[model samples]
Target chain A: MEFSLFNILDLLGTMAFAISGALAAMSRKLDLFGIFIIAFVTSIGGGTLRDVLIGNTPVNWMENTNYVYLIGVVTILTIIFRNKINYLKTSLFLFDTIGLGIFTITGVETGIQNDLDPIISIALGAMTGTFGGVIRDILCNEIPVLFRKEIYATASLTGALIFVLLDELQVNTDITYLVTALTVISIRLLVVKYKISLPFFTLDQKKSPN
Target chain B: MEFSLFNILDLLGTMAFAISGALAAMSRKLDLFGIFIIAFVTSIGGGTLRDVLIGNTPVNWMENTNYVYLIGVVTILTIIFRNKINYLKTSLFLFDTIGLGIFTITGVETGIQNDLDPIISIALGAMTGTFGGVIRDILCNEIPVLFRKEIYATASLTGALIFVLLDELQVNTDITYLVTALTVISIRLLVVKYKISLPFFTLDQKKSPN
Candidate 1:
């Protein structure tokens, strides 16, 4: 039951990320092939990076053709409905948030399975959640929004920590998943709604008069 | 004998890449930690990505402490002699070329070991030769120069094809390496010297008159 639930959420997350990628490509006015490539990379780049770092061979997408089909479907649908997607913006954002939460847990669990330290697990989790968007932004020729003082990676980091802490405390697995996911989703929504952001750090150029 | 020669060349390449990364960081006026992070990522990001894709666990740097020490020493030395290093730009470019050639071979050999197709091996080789710079450019908030029509990845690709073709023709391994490396270096130098470049592809802004 848990396995099926997680699988469904994973597919949904992939679809949402793919759609976002397609939209980015359209905004950039890329060709059809470019749009497909962008969509595919944006959806899988983060998980692929995390898997590679953890030594998970073949990466997740390579092991399954389902991801390819899903991305293709999402890209086509997005292109066809381009004129109407504005009304679905809020829904897309919600799906993306849910994706962030779920992907974070998946990364943390994979790290744990690999016997990594809890801190590293949390880091892997946050990376899994955030790096896809980073890759997406970079491919589109912009600084990653995550690095631009956004609350995005922070929410993933916080939720990852909470997940690790709860697991260490021996909380029920299902309950732990729920709370951790909720924490990430809530933080992201609240931050976006309120325009909350991390403080920017600039290196001061003035030298001390020693 | 061959192993030691390759090892020395690999170290030289690593050092050159690290220095280049530090130079980039210095140009950006990043903080000390930022400098180190950029240098490290720029030197190893490509190989790490390749290893993970091929299911090599622990990665090369993680398994060997020498890579870390090399990067550290290179980073410090580059920082110390930043001004004088400008005079050595030619030598640095030579080292980077050698590194690209060697890294391309390493990636190809790994792919072959894993029973991947020759075409895939060549792709992996090009990726290994080029993705570090891609990651570095992205992290530094610029579109990758490779994407800007530089003759970089093409050189790697051409060398990789030559390497695979020679191997298939039953050429000796050492000869294969030498020839492939020379091809990449020659192409890179010629391209830079003659200002050769691929045609830029831009999306047509206006609809075609029907």
Candidate 2:
């Protein structure tokens, strides 16, 4: 009952993830089945891992099989509309950012509900936020975006930590979620736009030079 | 202590599955990462799914850490040895067959140990036995090989039934396992050699004949 808003965020997260997945597959010139597989993994992969880690029984997909059917529907439509698709890169990044934000919030909420410590919750949130894309990239045979991109997972971790901090301050749940989502989205969007990546040896170099 | 043999079988299973996955990825003309992805899934996918379904915590690969490392090692070696891999198809098939037999037996045994009924055990066994290749094919963007060729899942089911029946007769566990594995391998290998596949259904054909 406390997680009444979960259903909405869950569906939102899944839909956004699916769109991003399909776009990524398209960029790779994958066929219908390949596109579908990527879409399925991207949409559910992080949450699935999170759920298993948390010992959630029956899994999220089995409890509500409609997610499965929804993915199927989206995949079919993507294939049918393949030739009509344009703006390959930007739209995908946008969808991916949205998914990352939504899933981060939910994952943090779940860990909090489980009464995990603040640090563990933050880790869970980040895992929930980024693992799907990691899995998708790994399956597609690419180094995870986490490893290659600057501030990808780091952005998620930052947002999750902020959320935990705000919750400790007794902030309202809705506001915490909104602010956290914005935090994740803004950080990721900025990183993409400015090509701001994690400092490679920057931290170490500063310390050494000083 | 008695499970020492089970550990050995699992190691063999991993090797077998990895080999099959590598070959399949090569056939699909995947890049190195793609080959590794295929190999990883082929080696661990079914067990992961089963663990998830059965609420096995941490999942095996995530827990062991070694399993993931092993897959990576195999993938790298497979790539470097690609020139020598041409002669490996026969060995790959043999290893795959052995893995299938061992996996089917282990899966059914796990189900039984968990006190699941015969039907659920059969389902789990089949799922555990065949889901790896199914996931592999899907990742490669193909309809699963098992669906089209050699009565693959059917063979797993056949072994599961034999295990249940023999256990009911108070058969020794080792003998039962050996018998079931041999039965499955025989059926699968024979079918492969003979090019035996399930009959195709045509929409124009009448099921009324059944």
The two-chain DockQ for each candidate, comma-separated, is 0.12, 0.10
Per-model RMSD to reference: 7.7, 10.6
lDDT per residue (tens digit) for residues B146-188 in model 2: 5445667777878888989998899998899889889889998
Cα-based lDDT at residue B56, candidate 2: 73
Candidate 2 positional error at A144, Å: 1.7
lDDT (0-100) at residue A69 of candidate 1?
A: 79
Model 2 chain A weakest 10-residue run by lDDT? A201-210
In model 1, which residue pairs have backbone atoms overlapping below 3 Å? Answer: none
lDDT tens digits, residue span A122-155, model 1: 9999998887777777787766758654478889
Which pairs of residues have clashing backbones in candidate 2? A150-A197, A150-A198
Show where candidate 2 strays beyond 4 Å: A1-3, A202-210, B1-45, B57-87, B93-210
Looking at candidate 1, what is the lDDT of residue A57? 75
lDDT at position A210, candidate 1: 90
Among all windows of 10 consecutive residues in model 2 chain B, the one with the lowest summed lDDT is: B201-210
Clashes of each: 0, 2
Task: Tell me the deviation in Å of residue A84 in model 2.
Answer: 3.8
* Candidate 2 lDDT over residue span A60-85, tens digit each: 76456567677778766755664455
